[model samples]
Target: MQRATVERVRVAWTRSTLDDRRAAGRALIRELTAELVPGADLRIEQRCPGCGGPHGRPMLPHAPVLASVAYAGPWAVVAVGSDRDVAALGIDAEQERAAPDLAALFPLTSPPDLRGWTAIEAALKADGRGLLLSPDQVRLSPDGRATVPDGGEFRILPVATAPGLIVTLALRHPDPGPRPTRRP
Candidate 1:
């Protein structure tokens, strides 16, 4: 995992198998629980408590960390951050070329428009507030940034790992500092 700082936020990414992903998710909950409450052992289940949603958004029995999970192809990405911070984190991995129609398999499609839709969904999950925003309410720019409607304060970054898969993460408290410039 690489932990870097864009502004003051600590960002990290890890590539793991399905089993490792589950374990890593558990570890994340444990670490966050330790930080929020001393001497408290938190056991997080990998299932959603709300209407058996396809994306299992786990809720902490007692904690202040907001987390989201997404599974793409064979990889599962889980992001955790402070509840008040509202950092939207998402990740998707796929083969370099096109494969079966994911949309047909799952109700959600991975078209370009899906990027903004995912970002809005992620932002809503991170905010843990009302369900006022819809997939149609957000728009993704050609450069891959998403602008939320209603002047909601958020930062949207869409990541393309391969040719066919896209993951969008939206953070309400995005760091405004200049992004790190990479040299070829």
Candidate 2:
């Protein structure tokens, strides 16, 4: 976990339970990084767009690995990928719940269901823009493909994990090659 992340979590005035949950989620990212790159020092860069703060996308500075973390309710997912395999990778886990009012408010981009929403979010994250772009900018097709801004595209794979928990992995395709299909 980054020091800035730790400090932000510490200073937040949320409930102790919430703090623990957030801390655990951050710890999961650290644990995954350690396991993925054993015996190597890992540094995460969270460069905010405006102020270069710790609220930006997580970047592996010294390695070619890319990672993203998302936490919703009691679920958190950490996804990592090598540059050779994917230009960028994102994963999101969401709990199944009904929020009918939200649909009407964001009609144009609101997904028909939670899985679709997760897929779009994962694609946005994989694009390295996150919510910086409106949902309308990241159109999710019925075929689990996403048309991201900047002419990029992503392939989304959704999986049902524990009950009520949906996980989606989005991969931004690297440049075409003879073995483009191969992944690490």
Candidate 3:
């Protein structure tokens, strides 16, 4: 089975503006997909599953691949993989040392602290439901595995790319839906 891969690009965050970070994310997506799925006309689309609007998780329609993007502090991360390799993929990154109170709000999971939160968010992302699914519903193990209370299972990889930025990439359990049907 093929596997999804994630790449991160350092960002020059300015005044908490996300415009630059978002552009970097799209660029990362293009770079990752270039070698994986060559010659496919890729256009990132975000359609909220809840309301079918245009502001949701980023996706590459009709590209024979799955993609996800996340940003944390000065980093913009993107994950891309062939649709056949994994069901779905989601990524999330956060500044671990930047928030102690928020980190303490949730009990520690496998990776512990903010890393655990990223894993949970990654899983929720792969599920394509986002926060619509309660974080409490997801359970993570130290061995790179996550199980949602009644949803899809995922394999998670937690990485400490920078001194304080933690990024996690997750893949949903096999059986990606029929490609043509799902927009993602």
Best by lDDT: 3
Model 1: lDDT equals 0.50
lDDT of 3 by residue, 1-184 (tens): 1123343212121113466777777777776677777898778888888888876698888687787877776567777777777777888888766643543334463335677888888998888888787686688887888887666688888654555677788886456457786676
TM-score of predicted model 2?
Answer: 0.75
Global fold similarity of model 1 (TM-score): 0.53
**TM-scores, each model vs. reference:** 0.53, 0.75, 0.76
Candidate 2 segments whose C-alpha is farther than 4 A from its true place: 1-17, 98-101, 104-110, 176-184
The lDDT-based order of candidates, best leading, equals 3, 2, 1
Q: Residue by residue across 39-68, what tens digits does model 1's lDDT show? A: 654656544345544335555656665555
User: How high a TM-score does candidate 3 get?
Assistant: 0.76
Candidate 2 lDDT tens digits, 1-184: 3211110111001112544655565565556566656765576768866566776677778876677776666555566666666676777667677323346435665444677777778888888777777766677777878889794888887654556666677787578767656778
Candidate 1, backbone clash total = 0
Error of 1 at 178 (Å): 27
Better of 1 and 3 by lDDT: 3
Give the winner by TM-score. 3
